[model samples]
Target: FSGTGTNMFKEEGAQQGFSSVTKSIGFSTDSITFGTIENGHLLLFETSSSRKLGEGRDCAYRCQDLESGRELALKMYKITNPDQRRAIFHDLYAQRSQVGKHERIVSYERVIESENTIFVLMELLNGKDLFDVICTEALTEEKARVLFRQLLEGVQHLHRKQVIHCDIKPENAMLLGSLEDGTANLKLIDFGCSCFKEFEADSRGCVVYDSYMPPEHVADSKLSPSVPTDMWRLGCTLYIMLVQRPPFHNDAQTQAGLAARQAGQLFRVPEYEALSPEARGLIEQLICGDPSKRPTCDEALNHPWLGLA
Candidate 1:
């Protein structure tokens, strides 16, 4: 009776005494074949099939909720090492409790736990990612200003909740559909590496996204993942949005080597000469190598380039 059928939920539920809610809503039972952790499983629903979302270390799926008729993003982690899995689960629980309500931050819905799989369901954003859009077309000054302001507002919102989104690259920023009145907006997603201020500890365990890590993060472990680190990444992202390239391109193999190149002030804005002076000035202040000099999200919001009307 269970042979990869579309209406399996109906027949299977009737035999078990499972209510219609469980059937209509999707839940795995004995009839459902569970896939191995190493190969992972592709979530399939009546309306949609899972699609690979990103690169490195983690796997994500784009799924559709048949009952709600809405799209959702699901992240699955297969941790075979007991210690590592425990650490990750602890951090996930901490993050689940700390991330407060914010429009810009992605909303976490529910956690599904099975014997071998852990799934986190998140809201699906419709518009293109900021990284893809900027790569295809350089953002106009007006457009960049609007987008950056929204970015800062989102970061500021996170700071208010004491959460530091250690990673703040363009890939993490999603352009949610324009307002009903037609104003474009962006939403920040992917908080796998995010940590609250109070949760700071040794940094050796987690895998960090390379291009966006700040100098302090590379230099010292005691500095703690802070608001400034996110600012440093914001600067780097803005630079790329305007010029279509990162400030530094050392091709270094290690964080220490990259740190050394950055210390030499190897990155510059020669490509951005055609941009407005205010834009260039803001970029200078943002990518200023020294973490102390970098502007906080609040200050960046007030910068002239982002303040443009």
Candidate 2:
């Protein structure tokens, strides 16, 4: 077993209350043939020309689909248990619409399970993740607004579907297209940690990115996790887009950061004051201390700052 059938963090890495992630999956250009016609559809990786996408519980490769003869992202998971593999296949099948309906969310095609491996075929996006953008690109207010509005629309769609993206950080968001051209649209990826509202009631103990998570997720045991958690992560993502840094950083490299996160303290340094008043107000509302006080994705879209309603 991969130990991540129901635990999202075990597969995604860097959980809020768990250990740190340091090792990354590496790939090389070596011609590798993955399957045969007898097994079903074959996935062939021309490693010499293939690109290595980021890793989680599975390794992703930009490869060719022998059946369709189209380029796609192949997410491979090695699971020894047949039952566990079937569970994953069923889980993804149920949420295909919610996750793949909007252009902003990555599309899921089909799942191919073999002897001891599971391969998930998905849309191959041509762009950089928001995390890379934060570290390397400079943005004007207008550009920032364009990117943020797309993000909100994506969240709004998920909420409308009664879905909550528990993990909504820069790393989970991507800008489609060439980074140098800067014309790519934004898309939300990685639904491994997300849950439908009904399913969330039973969902417990998720490892989240500390900076974007709300106080309730880490500190207060009585508060139930819900839509508000996504709101908090959205706000943190926006803050990073505008300032290129998280609003709250409690020495993230050490245990102190985890302690600070568990304490449930959220504050912005002077960098926040420099942003437009409307922008600041939105962030304040999204990261409100009280979960009930935070605006839902629909309400946030209608907020004055976004004028997206």
Candidate 3:
């Protein structure tokens, strides 16, 4: 741990219903330190460099409680610019507030804020993301159905709460466990771009995965995340789950190739055609270029292809 603070103690108190009794643990001038406490509780403290796992600006560490033998993931975000720090903190708080008890969303355990860095404690997803799953295996119809159903449930939950997951993509959905459990348990994660917007302000800015964006989003840069926008991305995800690739293939080199492809290309539902007619019909309705024709979450839930009946 490199960014621990006295805040975790206060947070623990607050969560235990002691809102007024705020106490600070001792702090170090150097990077915070994390270790296991004697009572078996994992103590995540801050350290100077925090253990570096991989590349990227995010700093992370693994802590084990000496007493309990429990482990935890501690992440610290180094805040340089005050404005950017505020924005990131705001986003984190908003995400925490919006998804209070949603099962499909990642749970926010606690936040540690110091002068130079902020630490967010979250549930570490154990399985691979949907992106890796798709890249490794050719999804069978049963597998696709199971995953898409869970994805739809998550999207529907967000819509019902009036939150738009601006960035919907394979990389953002995590597989919870093995796919052999009759369902490919999936969890929708990453809300850095999610927003709560009024109907009038819905069309302000484009926020989405480029390959999954709809024609309207590509055509109008003013489009904001909404039910339809999510649907379009869901369509793309389903297409990928079934076909092992996006409907429109764009090289990583092109800046606007994905948007261009989304704007002009026609996607033939190859995966659907190989499945039952009901499944094919559902895919057709979902991937329709015209946003008005796309099925809403509720409608999709009720679709015969889902076997919801």
Candidate 4:
């Protein structure tokens, strides 16, 4: 037998068998189907010439809904091992309820299971991610408040439903227009890590980017994501938007050590401060060492920093 195992990749046109596995360009339109489309087949296209969006373990395809004639993003997960695949598929299925459509959160269409893979259909977004938007300069107080209000509204919706977005960061937040335009809509995406957890609870270790991971998350090994953890990460994300860098970010050579140190350290506003006292105070409260001290989503929405109080 060949050493190559069963791995899924994209290719153009239709074909079958192991040789087709070498198709390096686009996914086979034949094998992929969400279900029987009354209008026609589900047509798939590349987001760019590269034929994929983003990098890492996840693969997303830009497709058109034949019936609705709307653009959608298909997030595919290729898991060959049966056990691992089943676990992932079940986890996503279980969390399906948590991904309800919301104005602030990216809309999740449905989950598709085909063979050993899983496809997550979501609303295709246009414009830039928060990381790209905030990388160069700090956001103006007005713009920051607008974005923060929208973000909190979305998070509040999730928290009310007992869904904790375990991973909340600038990269997870998408902007619809240029930051300068002031009319840009912000939508929080990537709910794959989200799960149900109560406020001030502990969670397991699934944090990839520790800079934004809260002390409670880093300290607790058994706890899953909690409301306080999400709020803490939101605080870090806000700090990045206002200052273009995480509050605990450092130039230290050892990133892991730095992140561990930051996770254990009490929250502090860095010297790169630009926001007013109220804004800083709000951030301090959000990232307070103790999870119970952080404000709830509604409380945060009405915080004086956003000038909404």
Per-candidate TM-score against the hidden true structure: 0.74, 0.75, 0.73, 0.75
lDDT of each: 0.63, 0.64, 0.62, 0.63
Model 4 per-residue lDDT tens digits across residues 1-309: 112212232221111111112333565533333432224444332222244667655556676665567788767555566534433543353335544467888776655444445556678888788888888666877788888888898899888877777778888888897656657789988765666443224335344345666665455546566788788888878777787766764432255534544443433555445468887888778877678888999889878878743
Off by over 4 Å in 2: 1-51, 81-98, 178-183, 198-201, 207-209, 221-224, 251-267
Better of 3 and 4 by lDDT: 4
lDDT of 1 at 59: 48
- Cα lDDT of model 3 by residue, 1-309, tens digit: 232333433332211111011224564223444333325544444334334433444434653333455555455555566445533543454445656357777665655454454555566666788998999999877777878888888888888877777678898888987888654578887665676553225435436545566666666676666687788778777777877767666642254654544443535556545767776677667767677778889999888878833
Error of 3 at 198 (Å): 8.3
lDDT score, candidate 2: 0.64
TM-score of 1: 0.74
Candidate 1, superposed: residue stretches over 4 Å from native: 1-50, 54-56, 79-95, 98-100, 178-181, 199-209, 251-266
> Could you say which candidate leads in lDDT?
2
lDDT of 1 by residue, 81-183 (tens): 5544643453354345545257776776555444444445667667778988888787888878878888888889888877777778898888876533456
Q: Could you tell me which 10 consecutive residues in candidate 4 have the lowest summed lDDT?
A: 12-21
Instruction: Give the TM-score comparing model 2 with the true structure, all chains together.
Output: 0.75
